[model samples]
Target: MRTLRRSTRGRIGRIDSRDAKTGIGAAELPALAGGRIERVSVAREQDSVASRFAERIREEEELRLSPLAARSYPAVRVRPEEDCALRTPFQRDRDRIVHCKAFRRLTHKTQVFVAPRGDHYRTRLTHTLEVTTISRTVARALALNEDLVEAIGLGHDLGHPPFGHIGEEVLDSCLKERFGEDFRHYEQSLRIVDELERDGMGLNLTEPVRDGIVRHSSRAPLPETLEGRIVRVIDRVAYINHDIDDAVRAGLLREEELPREPIEVLGSSGSARIDSLVHDMVEHSATAGDIVQGPRAGPAMAALRDFMFEHVYLGPAVRAEHAKISSVIRRLFEHYVEHPEQLPRDLAGGDGTAAEDVASRVTDYLAGMTDRYCIRRYTELQVPQAFAR
Candidate 1:
């Protein structure tokens, strides 16, 4: 067997004298035996880079964070099996979320418009990215744990169903009617990382990350961390602006038709509105020692949100399509409830004794579907096609 030697200056001395004749001196030879000089140099450079990155994380924790910032040291949930020398706990959470299957599914899920044909319309994935960008800006300004805020923002909508809020509403009503339970995307998002991801092995995320994902929705309870609170407010800031942009693009609403009072306070354009909200949040939150918006900007933002709900979200322009999608969701749920065996083995009850388990399994499977997949499956099951068509 060949002996393995680590790269070192001393090892270069072992090069053959013939190497000297080739204008390769001992000092110029590769330090690692049986490896190219470039390989050894690259390996050393990678090691140095990794070391500097780890050191930078530590220094950032010490020098950059404020007293109110959540520290990555002493993580709330320690997983000895998944510890990383190069990344802090929150950073690891962010990485895991970005790599998960659920996160990928967000690309195909509806954001506002159902199965919108326009390439520019925001999907669930784009919406999550916007939330993350806005949240990080606020987090960094406050000297908070941006990694934690990013993980939460990236994961906040991981459990959203295929047809936007209409899909969610259908699922909620179906669950309540069939099983005396409710379906909330926030709770489902928590369920995903904790139990459903990684083929049931789960992401095993830290407590703060999990808390932020479950509490990012305004309807949910406020999260315990400042990072979580930052994401919570930023979620509103992101969706309100982007949904308006999407509505205008869809020809459902005109930019000029937007309510004037809120526009005067927030800003005329989407970018200006986002800038105003973020700046106001940072200024107010820094002064208050907590995440908040200025007195003026807060109410103005709320009015903008209310305007979107009335004119775009619940508008007549999309009502017919929304009802059709809601009907599809209802029909799909009923079919699964009647035929649990059609579900994947992991989701279908093996013994079929517990109705609740069957309902839950069906719900899990349905919630994870993408918009196209849901529609395709609905067509296959509900619509009968003529032979050889």
Candidate 2:
């Protein structure tokens, strides 16, 4: 008979791991990455696909503590090889993203405020941090991959043009009509890494992180993992409440303007609204098995999201600004696609290929424009800035 050590991690439930280096109790499970769920069904109870999914989830969590092969792959990363490097491949990607110039520039970009003329409002940098904050918390709590989640959160905004979505819409409409709907931020993000970053380092992020970021968009998306789902929700959570705050600051929205029902459901203060949202999302994803509207606070949160879109996102003043910026971007696209030489060097010339290929190269050049650059280009082309003689 084998002598079994007493179970320190009571939650394993005869799962048997006296050899298990990391004893995982229920408390440990909740707190693993930052309060993520990490339980799998007992090995003998594999009766259905749903159970298998849960088991697979549990296995992933277990992988974090497990030691890799006897040797390390140094070319694969910048960090040194260690027995249990807390920083995984995905984590390296996160650090690289943080160090990148584009990530740092987010501080000057807008979240809601146009000029952001103040320091306190949510800039793109603050928004990214907020998303990271919520994404890590949810990923840790669900026992999903925190490194991948954080990476997704970090990479999610990499493709954002200057002045927030206003810049994107501007570029999209401008480039799309003539370029045949070829410009979108997600694909551009993929481009930044493939062709743009540091003469093409592209960050070389892992597959899961790429998938999460590609599908994070709301419209016409692709399949993704649990980490991606968390990112999708985090994007919404960061924008919805923050937009309301910005609108209020810009005097477009008033505390009194909130519809009574949404106000009750979302709470008054931004922090309270965020708390309600995060708690609701965690509860829903745990119980309903997805973040879609369902029992356990899902419906209320959905209502609040919708109320935000109606009262805040689509409000008239913002739409007018979106239109104005969109026009500027479109004009630039028309001008550049015709005079491709005027574009930046890397963007102007590509291997001979499809006409849209040329347009794509042009779009690549144009999309990278800073808000100031785009405005300057508009001035050069329209105003004849070549010195009045």
Summed backbone clashes in each candidate are: 0, 11
User: What is the Cα-based lDDT of residue 83 in candidate 1?
Assistant: 50
**What lDDT is reached at residue 115 by model 1?**
66
In terms of TM-score, the best-performing candidate is: 1
Q: TM per model? A: 0.86, 0.72
Cα RMSD to the true fold for all candidates: 5.7, 12.8
> Residue-wise lDDT of candidate 1 within 1-389, one digit each (tens)?
11223233212123344343355433333544456443335556446555565556767688989889887865666344545756888888899999999999999998889867689999999999999988998888888988888899999989898888888888999999999999999999998898888777788899989998998888988899999999899888988999999998999989889889889998999999999999999998897988988889999999998988888778887676887988788888999888887888764234363788878888898899999899888888876765312
**CA lDDT of each prediction against the hidden true structure:** 0.83, 0.65
Candidate 1 scores a C-alpha RMSD against the true structure in Å of 5.7
**Which residue runs does candidate 2 get wrong by more than 4 Å?**
1-86, 220-223, 288-296, 348-354, 384-389
lDDT of 2 by residue, 1-389 (tens): 11232232223334334224445543233324456656543432423433344344445556642221111122233223331233456776778678775677666666654655566788777888888889888776665667778877887777777667767766776655665574567777666654566654566766667777777877637435677878887788778878778878878778887766766876887788888878777776665555543353455556766876676566676676776677677777777667666665654345434677667776776666666666677777777655622
Task: Assess the local accuracy of residue 39 in candidate 1 as a C-alpha lDDT between 0 and 100.
Answer: 31
Candidate 1 deviant stretches above 4 angstroms:
1-56, 78-82, 348-353, 385-389
Best by lDDT: 1
